[model samples]
Target chain A: MSASLKSLPSNPAFTLPQSNDVQGTTSASGPHIPAEFEQTLTLLTSHRSVLGYLLLSRSQPVSIIRHSGVVFEGEQGRKYAHAVGRIVETVQAGLEEVAGESTDTDEIRFMRIRTKRHEIMISPDERFLLAVLHDPTS
Target chain B: MSASLKSLPSNPAFTLPQSNDVQGTTSASGPHIPAEFEQTLTLLTSHRSVLGYLLLSRSQPVSIIRHSGVVFEGEQGRKYAHAVGRIVETVQAGLEEVAGESTDTDEIRFMRIRTKRHEIMISPDERFLLAVLHDPTS
Candidate 1:
């Protein structure tokens, strides 16, 4: 597989020296992620199959909140971010169309795209979107 | 869930009176689908959770090869088909962009997008693309 084994924190814009302790702490990234979420991130990266994950703010401009894994770094990371946002938007629109018109409760909950090499799992909340890339065969 | 329970054959263009056989038979659908695939379809529809499936040919004008389930019927079915094709194309392009350039071996094998109500499983081959919609909670 082309994906790297080690998980790394790769934020494109902010280069602030961060704290290693995740207990009850927030991400240094743009959004004020909850302490529970930060703890969840700690738990997610510990798994063997999880290659990396990207957390994004779904507000205007769509910024990255936090990311893990080498595949979620630099230019490749940006592409993944863009694709995750676009796919969620597209699928939400498509679902509305399928139902004949837009409805308030028709919000998307989760999505998983499995490629030949990796699986991209996404979860969307009111303010945040999380995309996790994992190798199922691992 | 809004999805209907019964599985029905829903093809928009050609609705020939079909043969209801599973043993060593080809589909009445176009593009010469193999007997093994038709048998597989039979096996798939037998499952309790699988609400429906759509099989499409990836030719110049993508056409529906075979479809099962009420969610895959009529105008709604058309919407699903169009969305499936578009999503596949978008994801493929996104993968290429992630890789920085196009490669021959970067073909998408499978994709699963789980919405609040349904789960869509897609498998792409050299000639056909199969999309199966199932209720995971069921």
Candidate 2:
């Protein structure tokens, strides 16, 4: 994953809309994803199988930092975001319960969910949660 | 996955303890996993990286049909089972919401979650839910 991020350092054509103004701003309102991360999103969405991608702030009152494609537009985006939050929380809590400890070292890294029509790949971190939906068979 | 099931027909040495009594019973009380599934579980547990697996009956009361390894023993198994239910439900609901329809055609097929120490793979169906936990690095 880090290799992919480093691969595309300055893909101007792939620069995201939100990254334009909030390049380095880390306001308390929401997270400030690095330019490399945005490039990675762009690279991921460029795949023919990929339908869209959603990047969310993982802090309290999770917020959508950036979203791409039609599937994650309007109310549907909010619904998917909420689902992501719940799924992450459930898995993290379950892991902690199994370990019987809440150590910082133990945390979720990735999730891949395959449905009838789409495959959702999620990368979760301390500050951001990224989900990419794609057609696996394609 | 299907190939693995076909590989093992009856390995008495690896046959789970439950399979001995509930070989061909599918009572309304709980799910009746086929003999092949039990063999698959046996095959999976034989892997050095695998920590455990939980096979749950996805019915009204969601009972555990079979579980392997110490990681999934006792109350810990119950917690993981509950988490699986919630994760499946949340993802299924989110998919339906995105499609804007409650079509039976749209449903979750599989989920793989990765944490710091373990990688959990879940296969959910109408009658059964199976989860396998393993150490990815190993």
Provide the TM-score for each candidate, comma-separated: 0.75, 0.77
Per-residue CA lDDT of candidate 2, range B1-103, in tens? 3444323222232233434444466678766677767677877888776788888877645678889989789988887887777677777766776667655
How good is the docking of model 1, as DockQ? 0.50
Which candidate number would show the highest lDDT if scored against the true structure? 2
RMSD of 2: 7.8
Cα lDDT of candidate 1 equals: 0.68
Best by the TM-score measure? 2
lDDT tens readout by residue for model 1, B1-138: 324332221221112112233233434645676666776687778877888889887764557877999989987787888878877777877777787755643557676676778777777766677888878677
Residue B137 error, candidate 1, Å: 3.3
Predicted candidate 1 versus true structure: per-residue lDDT over A1-138, tens digit per residue? 324332221221111113233333434744566665776687678867788889887765567878999989987888889988877777777777777764643556666676778877777766778888878678
lDDT for B121 in candidate 2 is: 81
lDDT of 2 at A3: 42
> Which consecutive 10 residues in model 1 chain A have the weakest lDDT in total?
A8-17
